[model samples]
Every structure is written in structure tokens, then in C-alpha cells.
Target: MVYIRRSNTRVVTERNLDFKEEFQKKLSIIEDGLKTYLPHEDEKPEIIHQAMRYSVSSGGKRIRPILAMATYEMFDRDVKYILPVACAIEYIHTYSLIHDDLPAMDNDDFRRGKPTSHRVFGEAIAILAGDALLTHAFNVIYESALTYSERMKLYVLAGKEIAEACDSKGLVGGQVIDINSVSIIDTSEKLMDMDIRKTGCLIRASVVAGAIIGGAGSSDILYLNTFGEKLGLAFQVQDDILDYKENEIFPDKPTYTSILGIEGAREYVKKLSKDAIDSLNIFGDKAAFLRNLTMSLIDRKA
Candidate 1:
């Protein structure tokens, strides 16, 4: 006998939305929740908390958190229930950015076009603030799992993916390779492997965690992960393409554009974005926002 594959995803509503309008609405909600969830600047150990807030409140697109929420909302409309977990994604992303911009890492002087955390807060406080955000992410996940979830397994699954996404072999490992690559020659495979871990892991985790937490069945989880993976790779490739368009290079380390050339890189991004959108076809029209989001990710400027 033969069997046909199917999507186990569900829909909470059928209202059509202008993609930009929906994105802004969801982004606003995420921003408000993130502010309320973070430590107050005037709290004890004020400078650390201030640094945390400064980075957290910076002009980010809130894409990761919104991706989580959007994926979750596909199966259920309980945004309140998932708000904390979603915030955890933002915290995790922010922590990565803070540390990535430290004097020892990317050694950047800015983030979101503003002074980097280390530039304003000093290195010691910057490091500590990153630590604080990193530690707090787990707490938010654990608390949200216990407090708002009917099925602890859902949050457990989400937490597991989020944690693994930050593992030495995942996000951190990618960063390590990047920093160490200045003197090393790289192949296309090596570059892709590193980028997938460094930049793609969290983006993949965002959607996978969201889809699983949103009540997708086992098959749906697999397909959604595929969607996340494709979308994530496309995002990185597009970033490289954008950089190449400006300066024809990414400073150091290898980029997809460096390996594939400009047109090849654009083709690569286009194919991945199409594949990502096609992955959503399994869920029918319920995944409209996700499809729109995947396409938009490649074209974003900041």
C-alpha cells in the first residue's frame, strides 16, 4: 500500500492581511512584551540591567521573536501563552549580538547603527550583560513552560531546540570558526557549514520551536524544520549578497557571494526562498504569513 504525506498544522483564523501591516502589528506586540519582560534600568545592579535594556530596546526588527509567535499562532491564537517563550528568542538573539560586538569578537563599534553595548557600557559590563541575557533566556522558557502551557512537553521541546541552537556546535561554534578563519583559506562547503551554525541555527530554531510549540504533529515538525533551514540559509546568502553589492567583499572570512559570485549568490537565495515557501504549501493557506516572511527576509536592509 502507498501513503500520501500531509500537514498537521492548524489555523486559528482566516483573515487576509497586508503583509507589512501584519508584520508591523505583530512587531509592535513583540516590542511591548519584550520591554515589560526585561529588567528595569533602575533596578539593583542598575548598569548591567541598563546595558541589557539598551541593547534589547535598540531598533531591531524583532524578527526571531515574531517568527516564533507567528508560527505558534498558526495553530493557536494564544499569543499571551507564548509571549515569554517568544521573548526568550529575542533575549537569546540579543545576547549573541552583544557578545558578537564585544572588543574580542567582531569588535564592532555599533549595533543597529547605534553604539555597541561595549562602546557605551565598557567591556566588563558588556560581557556581564550578555551573560545576564543568556541566562535569563532559559528562565523565561522554563517559566513560560510551567506557567502558561497545558502540555509541558511542548515547552520542553521548544526549550530543547532553543538550547541546542546555542550549543558549542551550533551558534557559538559558528562564531568560533568565523573568528578563527582570518588566516585560514576556506571552501564553499566550509563556509556554508559555518554560516548554517552561526547565523542559521537561531533562525531555524525560531520556527521549529514555534511550530512544535504550536501543536504541529511529528511530520509537520520535520517539514517546518526544513522550511526553517531553507529560509535561514537564504537569509545568510542574501546578507553576503548585500555586502558584496556595497563593497564586493565581506572584509574577511568567506561568504556565499565570494564562493558563488554575485548572480550565483542571488540565484542561490532565490531558490532557497522558493523552497522555503514551497515547504509551507503542506499547510495550505494557514501559513501565509510565514511564506511572506520567508520572502521578505532575503530583501531586508537591516
Candidate 2:
């Protein structure tokens, strides 16, 4: 087994940073960080701040940040140093969801069981809120401190990874294909490509960024990169399964279930999930949370 050097040792205080509790602990930290960094409700231009806050505060799993911290923790890096970067990921994710739900986009009326940002704040406010959240993510990352000297370079590298993921050929590109692929995606490979870009890109960035912050070696970095991509794809497949069960309004959209059937998609999820777990084998027991996370993500209900 290849050993990773220059990584943080696990904090002595937390002996059991594994299982369900670890997941909740990381999620709670991310949730609080998100709330703390969001613009105040009474800040200048109250309406915009309110809209942005509303969007960020809306309930969700906060998985992106969790992924970042979990990866960072696996390398024994102090999670505090990476919190802002992790939070930045959530901001970007929230922005995407808000914009995706707008009238010109997915046109959804609800998110996390509440009215969507646009539905409550109007289309213009929702658009601005998404824009603000996206900008805020980068701004926070740029302004936040990196504890290590090499972290500056790592920051730039990881930031570029995230930016590229958000670019036209990644997140937006995936969404564009989502809109256009109903007729184009006849094969499982083609559909998986679209899913990877839209969902897997950001997820990959989350873990990749964490590894960078933790000073992981090239081999470990490569393993985590593959893990993130496989996990991200599994995540999207799980979402497709959920949508198949909970909603059917978008029958026109291409999904794994649409092409592979529910049983087939479930089997696909198991395959991707196993690949993700295998990716962590290089890390040994240090990756318990991440390995379990892969299973939890697959079994998620909401």
C-alpha cells in the first residue's frame, strides 16, 4: 500500500470520527459556517441579502462541504483551515440549485420542502441571489487564510479545479445537455457522460480540493479524484432513482432510470459505489467516514 506523507494526523481529541455521528458533526459544522458567512438579513440592500440568505439557509444535506471536510480529515489535515473552502462549495451548490429552479430554468416551485428562491423573492431577486452566492463562494475562498505556505499554490490549483467544474463544459454544460439530451442519449455511456459533468464535476472538486489542502501525495490525489468522480456519478444515479419514485413531471428528461430502468439504475449505483469504496483502499482505515459516506449516499431517501 502506498502511504501518504505530509498529511495531518487525526486530532487526538476525536478518536471516533467515523460512522453516523461523524457525518452529522461535519454537516452541522458546515451548516453553521454557511449561516455565519451569509450576508446579514439587515445588510445593505436588504431584499437581496434576504433572498440570498433564504436560499443558503434552505435545508439540504450540505454534502459538498461534508465531502471536503471528510476528505481533509482522512489526511489528518485540520478541518478548520479548509472550512471556508468547504463553505465556498456549499455556496456554489446553493446558487446552482436556486438558479436551476428559476422560471427560465427548471421552473421548480419548491426546494428542500419550501418555496424556491424565485417563487418567494420573484424571478429577478432569485437570479441575483444565485449570482451573489456564486460570487460570494469565490470571494470567501480568496479572502480566507491557508495555514501552510504551499497552501497558496494548492489554493490556486484547487480553485481552478472548481472554476473549471463550474464552467460551460462542466456544470452548465451538463445542465444544457439535460435540456437537450432526451433524443441524443440512446446509450448508457452517453447518459453517464452528461451526469458526470453536471453532478460529478463539483463533487470531484470537493474531494480534490480537500486533498490539495491536506498536502496529499500525487498517488493519493489520483485515487481521491477517481473516488470523487465515481461517488458523484452514483449520487446522480441515486437522485434519478428518487425522482423516479417521488416525481415524474420530467419524463422528457434523460435519466439512468429512463434508460436503464429502476432495477438497472440501482445495480449501476451499487457498481459505482463499490468503485468509490475501492478507491479509498489506498488510505486504509483513515477513510472510514468517506467509505461509509459512499454507502449512506447510495441509501439516502431525500
Candidate 3:
């Protein structure tokens, strides 16, 4: 049970200068950690290396890896043991985003404010790039096992967890629901189920993987799992809010707001964000970053 003393001072407002500085600092650490942990190209595999680098370095919020590092730090664990797992989590996530943006999927032309993989690389290469990232994520975890014997077991377990989350039982299954539901007119319950498997699963894995790598006890891990589950739902709800906002800007864009109504969607996101913060109470102040990040998700415009 790791804990930090609660401050007597009020919660720092997001507009505070210190909050922006701390957020940027965390983002820098995450970016550097990702670059350091990514595979180095030798002379032999130029194309694969190029695709991997292109997909990963395209720039988005490195939220998954940052969450992993934050959880590891909360428990006073060595960052080294968690770095590989954090990188792997990001790889898996990036792969999903790549595939999600493909022609047969969401058919998006832009992601993270740039051309999507398929749009730039052709569909075949984009598919292969996603496949490579997915498989290479496992490779990273396996390679780490060779060096850290004591941490090897946890790494293996985290790898297995990731596999489960990315497979039919997790993200893919949720995606299947999302595709099928596109024309069906979504109900609240159906949307919840779809988002849980599609987006929530990986977010849940990100937090749990951090706990596993940090060697947290069963109780702590359980609490973290709960936290992740709630956070995951909150994240998707925030995405829904963003979708609605976009629809307002461009009336032609498809959006949840069209289906749920703006006020209803906003209320739903609010409820999810509250639930997410409530789950962090078990971790006390040790979960400060997680708590703040969850709130940030709810408040974000993009």
C-alpha cells in the first residue's frame, strides 16, 4: 500500500502556471523515454524500421506510457523495469490507431493532425505496419525478460495481459461491436459495452501493466485495476464529447451528439469522470497524477 500525504493546500487549478509546467515536463519525459526504448535500426531491416518509426513518431499524447511511469513512480519502483512495458503498451496502442484509421475501418484521412498511415503508405503497407508494431511490442517484452530475471515473471504476465486485451476478448471485440452498431442507432447500454471493449480495455491494461511491472501487491494491483477501468470509461466519454464538439464545428461530420443529444452526452461524460475520480480514492495521494489526468481528460477540448 503505497501512499503520499495529502496536501493541506487546495487542488491546483488546471489554469495554474505550475500545472502547465508540470504537464509539459511529464510529456517531455514520456517522449524521451519512448525514443530511448524504441528499437534501434541496424543495417538489415530498413523498411520495417522506417515504418515503425514513422508510425510511432507521428506524435500524439504519450498518455499510456506516461500513465505506466506515473504508476511505477507512485510505488517508488525503478523506472527501468517499467520502461519496456510502457513502450510496448504504446506500440500496441499505436497499432490499434493505425488499423482503426484504415479504409475498411473508420476511413479517416487524418489522425493526430496528420495524414493517417494508410493515406501515406498505401493500404497494404499500412496493414503491415500495424501488424509489425503489434508483434514487435511482444518482442520488446520478451527481450526485456532476458536481462531482468526477478522482473521477468511480471513482464511475462504483463505481456499475456496485453495479448488478452488486444485480442478478441478485448479491443477487437469492442471494435466489432462498434462497426456493427454504426447503422443500428446506439442505445446507452450498447454504447457503453462497445466503448468498454474498444477503448477502455487498452487504457485499463496500461494502468494494470504499470502496477505489475512495479511489483505492486495483489491488493494494490486490484485497486489500480479498478482505477484503470474507471479511467478507461471516462476517456471514451471524453472522446464522445469531442466528437460532439467537432460536429458542432462541421455539421457534416458524424458524431455521438447527433445520436445522444449534446446535453445527454455531456451529462454522461460528467458521470463517467466523477466515477473515475472516485476510484482513485483508494490510492490516496499516491495517485495524484492519475487523478489530475482523469480530470484533464474530461476538461480537454481535443
Candidate 4:
């Protein structure tokens, strides 16, 4: 759905022709980029390549990369420059999912309606697939940076952002905390911290890396960073709420709804969602597509 801002009021509009067309066009570009960046399944070490393709090509909303593209577009229309990095972000996200579903992790049998990587390729292959994607993500960024020799520093900074997000103090750290927790997360501070590190870091990397490549100034970068953090947390909270609504919440796991209760969780989502949208004011009408995308995400059923 599209979100239009009228002076002093923000209105929600159904996803109409204009918004759909624009969003679809961008999505098409991102899909094509992912295909081009990924290795061919027939390449050497075909098993690992096949597993990577299988996991990444599985049906899912390509939100992270799309966020990067949209954020980049806010400053520069030439999205080609950012496409590689955007796809790399997806590769990293896909890698995380592969690992998350491993036998040692969540041990799920399916992902995005398809058999999980381990289920399809066996555990060893699945682990290697995740490892390959994680390492390849950096190579994609590096190759893209080489192509854009003049903007090497910007690319370096973008790569660093993604790297740190997935590193020990970020996504991995959060995962460790999640798997190691001996008791239910009873405090808002601890849960928020874990959620931000685990889920929000990569999202923050997506927006910040896009802005960096787009040559945004410090203030703009700060605003987009804030936007990403708030949006990421809101996204997770909403997911918790949905699980609760669907009777899928695990008693052993602590979610936003678990800690805050349903009504309180809903209220938190509203606050975070509003803050996320408000952070885009600096981009003015140029951010309409992003604003609408943000609204749609918060209200998504799945």
C-alpha cells in the first residue's frame, strides 16, 4: 500500500497503479541483480553451488536488498552502482537463514515453503552453502567496488557496515545470546538489546550502506540509520504479534508480545513505525516510495 503525506497528516492509501508499478519495477531489477551475482549451479563444486541457489532462490520477500535500492534511489537514480552491494546484502541474509535452519540451530524442515537447505542437501552441504554465501558476499562487494574505481572508499565503507553487522557483536552475538539464554527474557532492556543486535543490525547495514554509496551527508546518514533501527525493531515486534495471532508463539521463546503483552506490543509497534516514517522527513517527497514501503511492511499479514 502507498503512504502519502499531506501537510500535518499522513494518509494510508491502497496500493494503486502508480505505487505498484514503481515497486514492481524496482523489485524486478533486484531479482535480476541477484541472479547475475549468484554463481551458476553447474559450476565446479556443484553441490555447494546448487545448495546456495536452492536456498537463495526459494520464494521470499526480498526486503533487505530492496531497502538498499530504495534508500540509494533517494539520492541517486542510477541504482546500477548499488545493485551488487544490494545483492550482497541479500546473500548475507540468505546465508544467515541457511545457518539459522541448520540442525544445530532452529532445525526447521522448511523455509519459505520449500525444504530447508539441510533437508534438501544434507547437513554438511548446508553448512558449506552458508559458509560459501557469507564469503562470496564480500567478494561481490569487492568486485563491484573495483568496477566503480572512483567510489572505492564509499564501497569500502559500505562493505565494512555489512561486515560488522554480521560479525560477533551483531547478528552472531545476538544468536549466541538467544541460544544460550537459560531463562525467559523478562526485561524489556535485555530483549530489546538482543533483538536490535540480532535482527536490526543487518537492516541498519542495509540502509546505511545504501546511503553511504549514494553519497549522503552525515546528517542524512544518521537519519536513515535511525529509520532502519526503528523499522527493524518494529518489523520483529510485528512478527511476534502475528505469531501470537496465529497461535504459533512458542512458550519457551520470548517475543515482544510475550514481554509486553499483546496490547502493549501493538502500542510499541505504532511508536516505532511512526518514528521510522518521521525520520524520512529530511528526504521530503523524494522518500514517498520508501515511506509507503515502510507502512506496507508494518501492516503486512505475513
Candidate 5:
């Protein structure tokens, strides 16, 4: 199995300055892009609008949108053409977060250091907000596709895949399995399967959307999808590790680490990250930012 050892001896205290700087720069661009796409103040149903904005503006990594933008930049530098779709990806991600934090789901009271959507807004409004954002994401993609220079068939493909990835068979299904697993005796294989569906599906969609919009060929798309799959797995493993570590220090929820053990989870993340980076070798020098981003994902603290 592919694996890379952590360069930092202390996982909790370590910070890579270069990775942080690059992530922040990309995050700023993504934030600006999202702001440009948000509904204007005059839009109807002000509470729903406010909740949607509140959910998105809660300050996470913005990794999905950045992945879309960076993947697009790999083959094309025209940021203007891709910004709408990037924002759409962010909208979908934020919607998932909002739903995931509900009392019926993860029941998370805080997200990205702030009150979750359900905590600030009532659960009914939070649910409506998530639904609205998910639907609005499609609208953004359709409108943005109209502005493309060549009437891209690939954009159409990306749009279809994005819809598929967010549906019952994708992230939502994965979430269902995750919630069910909490009460049952979950196996390692089961957890991995659930993670790939829940988290890996969107991650795959982000990379594929970037490749499609960037005009990458079939081979490039396949390689990037492989990279994204591995990255998604690594991301989940890292989350497990963090969850386990946090539970040790303070009150927290359950995680794969609670099931798999901390060392095993860390090792799993290392293996996934290695495979993710290995997948990029197929692109030669064309995927430098993608490669760097994969490495940064493994090394990231938050």
C-alpha cells in the first residue's frame, strides 16, 4: 500500500507556513468568487437568504471550490469563465454542512468555530436554507454554462456529475450509512465505503468538474479522479485522527479513530495521501498546483 510518513513529529502542534500561505491565497479568491454569486439584498424570503449566507460565510477551508478553480487553472488560466461553477461547488458543500449539523444528523452545535446553521436559525429554516442552496447551485451552473466561449460539452458533463454526486446515491447516501454505523458494529471496510461515498464523491466531482471546465482530455480526467479519490479518503482519515485526538482532550463525538484506533487511522491517512500524490505523476508537470494541494491536505492542521 502507498503511504507517506508525516514530516512533522508532533501532529497537533505542527504547521507548514508555505501550505498555510497558499491555502489562504486560494481561499481569498474562492471567497471573492462566492460573494460575486450570492443573491442580492433585494431577493425574496430574507430569512432563507440570511441562513444560506450564514452557512457559507461560517469560515471553513473552501477546499472544494479551490479544487475546482485550481484544476481549471491547470489547463486554462481564464478564471472568469470558471468562477460561477466554483461558487456552485461551494454552495453544494455548504448545504451539506448545514444538513450534517442538524439535530437528526451529526448534531454538531459548532462548525468552523461558530454556531451551526440550526443553532442560529431554527431547524426548519436551516433545512429550507440547505434545500435552497442545493437547488440554487444547479441554477448557477446552468447560467454560467451559457457564458462559456465554445459551448462546452464538458461543462454539461461536469454539471451532470455534480448533480449525481450530491444526490441520494452519492454524499447523502454516504451520510445515511455513517449515521447507521453509529448504532451498529461497523467494520473498517464498511467505514471506508461510507467515507468514499459521503466525502469522496464530492471531492471526485470537484476535481472532475475542474478538469472538464479546464478542457482536460480523458486520460487527464481519469488521473485527476484517481488523485481526488485518494485525497478524499485521506481527508476523512485525517478527520478521524483529529476527532480521536479531540475526544482525548475534551468532550467530543465519535469517529473512525474511536473505532479504528489513532495509530491505525494515522497510518491510513498516510497511505491515502501517498496514493493521491502518486496519481498526479500521470500529468507530468501540468498538475503542480494539484500536487501541492494534495500534499497540503495531508499536512494541514485545520
Candidate 6:
């Protein structure tokens, strides 16, 4: 049985309005950082650059980067130090989305209410754009780390965490399993293994990376890792529930709702959400923002 930490400290410590306002401020910062970091659309080899810019500029929750920044904030106040790595995580996420939407993959026509990279830029360019983002992210990480000569080692360790999370040991491995196991994903164990690796690893990496950059102690990092994993699973489960509600769930594909039923899935989301918030108890009131954010995710309408 998974241990769920219970705290007398409530999750709703902050007002909804304040939380939303703060979240938007962070979102705006992330948007600016992304634009700053990405290549200009008019750069030489214009098409790939444009495609890259287009996909990266496209709107999303920016949750991964925000998570990293928030985790860093728990220990350090100057989030600028974590900005490059945070944006790097978003680049990785965008690259995955671009590749996932290709004809060879999910064959999606749209993302974030806009045309997908392949749909707008054609398949070859989209593929190249994704590759560019993936490669560029590492450069950003490396170059940014050099700026902080004193904490260079921390940056290297954090970058390594990000790399492993997205490579064969994590996201890619899970994606391979997902693509191949449509028919074989019969048990919750198998399904969760895929979900944790595909989705949880990066989220976990984001939190852990932030903690590392912030100079967190090993035990603190361990707690944050658990928080990220629980939150990641809860986030995906909530997505499954929302997809079901919207009639967007593919019948042939296995999902939490399909495996556990809607009510069961809802209950699972609640449990995971609680566990995720509980994992933040070590932060006390300093974690109010993250705790509220965690609650908001499971309760989100969209």
C-alpha cells in the first residue's frame, strides 16, 4: 500500500484568485523566456527555424517549467538561475508533442487548439523542428550552467537527471511500450509502468532537477521525487477522465477510466492527489503555492 501523508495543514491555504494571479505571472515569465531562448523565425534556414518557433510559441500550461521554478523557489528566491533549465524542460515537452503528432505516431492534426507542427509545416520540417528543439535544449542547459561557475556541478547533475528522464530509460522507453502494448496493456501494473515512465519521469525530473539546482538535501530531494511521481500520475489520470468526459477517449486504447471505470478513476485521482500534496509536508507553509497548484490540477475543468 502506498503511504499517504496527512497534514492538519490544509491544501487551500491561499485564495483562488491569488493563486491564479501568481500562476499567470509565472506563465508570462516562461513565455518570455521561451521566446528569448528559441531561434528567431527569420534566421537562416528560415523554414525549420519558423517551424521551431511556431511550435514552441504555441500555448500550453507550461506546467513542467513552472514546477521546476516552484521547486527551486522552495529553497532559493532568485528563479533566474533556474530559468534556462526550466525552459529546457518545456522544449523537450514540445519536441515530444511534435513527434507524437507525426503520421508515424499519433497522427494528430492539432495541439493546443492550433494546427500541429506537421499539419502546418509538413512532416519533414516538423520532424526536423522537433530534432532541433531536442538538441538545442541541451545547448541551453550547458551554456546556462557555464554562467554559474560556482554551481556548475549542480547544473551538470540536474542536466543529467533531465537527460535520463527523456531518454531510453524513461520517456522514450515508456513511449515504446505504449505504442507496442495497445492490446497487451491489460493490467494496471503494466499501464502504470508506462504512465510513470512516459509522463512521471519528466515531471519527477523537473522537481528533482530544481531541488538539485537549489542545493536541496538528499532527503528533501527524495520527498520531492515522490511528490512529482504522484502528481504526474494524478495529472495523467485526470487527463484520462477529462478525455472520457469529452468523448475524446479512443476506444481501442487502454486508459484509467477504461481499466478502473469512471468513478473508480475519479477516486484514484483523489487518492493520488492527496498523496502528492502530502508529499509536500516537508515544506510546511512554504509549499502553499505548490500544494494549491496540485489541488487545482485535479480539480481543473480543462
Q: Rank the candidates by lDDT, best first.
A: 6, 4, 2, 1, 5, 3
Q: Mark the regions of model 2 whose C-alpha exceeds 4 Å error after superposition.
A: 1-18, 145-150, 245-250
Pairs in clash, predicted candidate 5? none
Regions of model 5 farther than 4 Å from truth: 1-22, 246-254
C-alpha RMSD values across all candidates = 5.8, 5.7, 3.9, 2.5, 4.5, 3.6
Alpha-carbon local distance difference test for all models: 0.84, 0.84, 0.77, 0.88, 0.81, 0.88
lDDT of 5 by residue, 1-302 (tens): 11223664454223344445666777888898787788853578788888888888888777888898888888898887678888899999999999999999989899888999999989999999999999999888888777674745767888998998988899998988877776653577777888888999999899889889888889889998898889988898887776565446322334667766788788888888878888888766666667767776777676
Q: What lDDT tens digits, residue by residue, belong to model 4 across residues 252-300?
A: 7688877788888999999999999999998888888878888888889
Tens-digit lDDT string for candidate 6 (135-194): 999899889888988889989999999999999979989888888877879877888999
Ranking by TM-score: 4, 6, 1, 2, 5, 3
True lDDT of residue 199, candidate 6:
90
Task: Tell me the spans in candidate 3 whose CA falls farther than 4 Å from its real position.
Answer: 1-19, 40-42, 245-256
lDDT score of residue 29 within candidate 1:
87
Write down the TM-score of every candidate: 0.91, 0.90, 0.88, 0.94, 0.88, 0.93
Candidate 3 C-alpha lDDT tens digits along 19-135: 457668767876776677666645346666666777899998788887877887777556778788888888989999899999898899998788988888789888988998899
Lowest summed lDDT window (length 10), candidate 4: 5-14
Model 1, span 36-149: residue lDDT tens: 888889999999999999999887878888889888888888788678888999999999999999978888998778999999989999899999999998988888777865
* Candidates 3 and 5 compared by TM-score, better number: 5
Predicted model with the maximum TM-score = 4
Instruction: For candidate 3, give the lDDT.
Output: 0.77
Model 3: residue 194 alpha-carbon error in angstroms: 0.9
Error of 3 at 265 (Å): 1.9
